[model samples]
Target: MNGLLKKQFGLVLMLMLLAMLMYACAPDEAPVDEGGSSDEEESSSDEGSSEDSSNEGSSDGEISGELEIQYFVGGYGDSWWKEVISDFEEEYPDVSVTEHAGPNINEEMRSRWVSGDPPDVVYIDGAGSSETQMVEDDQLMNLTEWAEGIELEDGSSLVDSFIAEPSTYDGELYSLPLVFDAWGTWYDMNRFEENGYEVPKGFESFMSTMGEIQENEDIEPFVTTGQHPYYFSRGMLYPAFAAHGGNELLADIVQGAEGAWETEEAEEIMSNVEEMVDAGYVDSGLGALNHTQSQMNFLLGDNAFIPVGFWLPNEMEGDKPEDLQYGFIPSPMNPEDEPMAIVPDLRPLAIAEEAENPEAAKAFVEFVFTREYAELFSEHTGAIMNLEGVDLANNENVPEYLIQANEMINDPEQVEIFYKPHPMSADLETPISDSLVSLLLGNITAEEFIQEAEEAAAEYREGQE
Candidate 1:
């Protein structure tokens, strides 16, 4: 009986030892809840879902949506747009872009804008598009905050990169200046050199130069369009006004202040035009010509100098003579001592107030304002972008005249740039343009032009009231 009891104890001890060895060899079990899922497994599942949510659009968390862009086709053309869009797609592969662009895009997109379902982005240029009107109609998004702190790829402030700041209303930015265009006088360098003519420095030099050109060259010394008299009024007269009376006079003229156009400065500018007309330095047949016709005449060597924008070369690219060498200068409307004044004509780019894809729109805006794109713009458009620090002089693709003009534009000592606080109303501009045509044709005196302009300003103000 003692031996059997000992055997039973030994068997029990062996069974207990086997159980301990099995427990040691088996895998560890996690703490499980009532649902049969372990805590560790639940945690891992939650982490995986979080990662997927973070990368919904792309692995790098890029925005993905339909981005509609509206741009106008003009002298700049649409090649740059196509290339940039392709590049943007490569950067954000998931985003889809739709272009609403053409020469008449402003008119074509009018209905969409009126119905409050405009495209994501809009380039305010060409006919039928006015940035001021858009602001009044509440069609643009306020980009002041986003623009203030935005940075370029090289760690420079985006706003600081602009050659000119965007126009603002009530201290809020609505549009960015995308194109850097300035009104100035254009001539053929080769023609001037052949005639031994010098570029004018100021009003006095301008008159003398015109006289010299008139006496020597068979071509008209100066030419401007009557159909678009703003070529003279805004291009030459406005800059002269600023140079004479500074920004204060410009503000008054823009506001249509009573007799603003009859100031001493205005009289002097009109008198200068009168002097040119009386001397026969002005083209007598301009009253019958439109902008393109006048420009064509200038390009054909019928005229020695013409007032126009930087787009002249690009606009007349196909028609320009092979021997023609473009030359540009700010209208020498200032006195001999004062620096030349530049009136920059900025084309604005805006975001719609009701964009379907705000993120993509903002992203595109940021993407477009880089130096790389600015150089591309110069390469494709043959004109400068609104960005600062673009090296156009060294670029073989850029025209030599544009390179020289850009240097003058950036030199503060050579030029003083200014803008009117507001755009002139159609009512005000129409009569001014008409009177200018009459004045240039030698039918109206300087005093008469001023009287007509002041009367028009009064009428515009009364209509506004």
Candidate 2:
């Protein structure tokens, strides 16, 4: 079997076993008889479900009732959710918490979101559903005032608790960013060092270096997950945004300003991609490879580099190279200056505006930043939380690669920072990804790619009107 299929089959089987195991050892706690009717009892048969454990006390009434929590079960998993919910239950004895999580948790929650019966708290990650779209549609809560003066046990407001405050649009806070996904070009340091390859810093020099390496060694310099070509575009797009014009250009493109995608600055970015394709640096088999196959091929020396996230180590934990020596570099955007690393802020947690239990959702969000919750997050997920001053270096559960990545980005002297996202509408993301993929596969020209994207953006704006 192919690498991706093998891995997927294993995951499916594992999840099946996990379901059976959990069922055998599952706790059957009766619902808390809250005098009134219990919403918790009714939601137990949900698509992704965990029963709200029966709890004592609760007359304090700070924030009571069922907290409908929806979260993505991706690389981070759902263990952290269970840990934090237990903490929330302890803190607010009157409240009942349940877990509703799956790989497609966000997709499953869509009908509820539209019907104004959304979960109190939702993890705003993954594709299809977007926090930005939700904000534009006026379906999200404005957390501005709540953020300014939330009381924490440490006597600091919630605004002061984070390393960086959540992203805002129009001076209104609508979502809270929790998880950090660092994207870049990944390589094997041992192979590079052994082969005496100096990391190239500029786009022109990087292309030259790839040419020289191809001439001298058996190394195939670049490969992208071909079946999912978006993986290649995902990392480089941000640096390209910064190189062309940064936020000013990003705003124009996102707002669907006329001719924004056709500018010379934008062309510079796509042309570089074309140059790579023309030089034959891209893998021929790139069109057939899935993410797992590509990563495995990368490790096996079939290719020298791949575009991936910090979650690489976790994903390939068992299959990683011995003496790993992993290294990362930003996609070179310009010929002269050192390329800026693309560190997009991710908002994984948000409270719905029209939640059945809004106060409880806000309380749950506030409770997430506390020391207990942060440590549990690191311990289970190994993701670098935005909560500052939590030293997780000694935590056994924290992956070593994550610790290295955390230190690399936190030190400002390392490289320039590109702080913006794609800023394109949700509808355009896939089309643009496809366009880039097509360019690499020799099916489309760079100009043709941009034209296709611009056409899609125009359609999106017209529908918005």
Model 2 score (lDDT): 0.72
- Global CA lDDT of candidate 1, please? 0.83
Q: How big is the positional error of residue 304 in model 1, measured in Å on the Cα after superposition?
A: 1.1
All candidates: TM-score: 0.81, 0.79
Model 1 agreement with the true structure over 367-454: per-residue lDDT tens digits: 8888888988988887888988887878898877778888888799999999765456556677788999999999999998888888
Clashes of each: 0, 0
Q: What C-alpha lDDT do the candidate models reach, one value each? A: 0.83, 0.72
**Model 1 segments more than 4 A misplaced:** 1-62, 422-431, 462-465
C-alpha positional error of residue 46 in candidate 2 after TM-score superposition, expressed in Å: 24
Model 2 regions more than 4 Å off = 1-61, 151-153, 160-165, 212-219, 226-230, 288-290, 392-400, 421-423
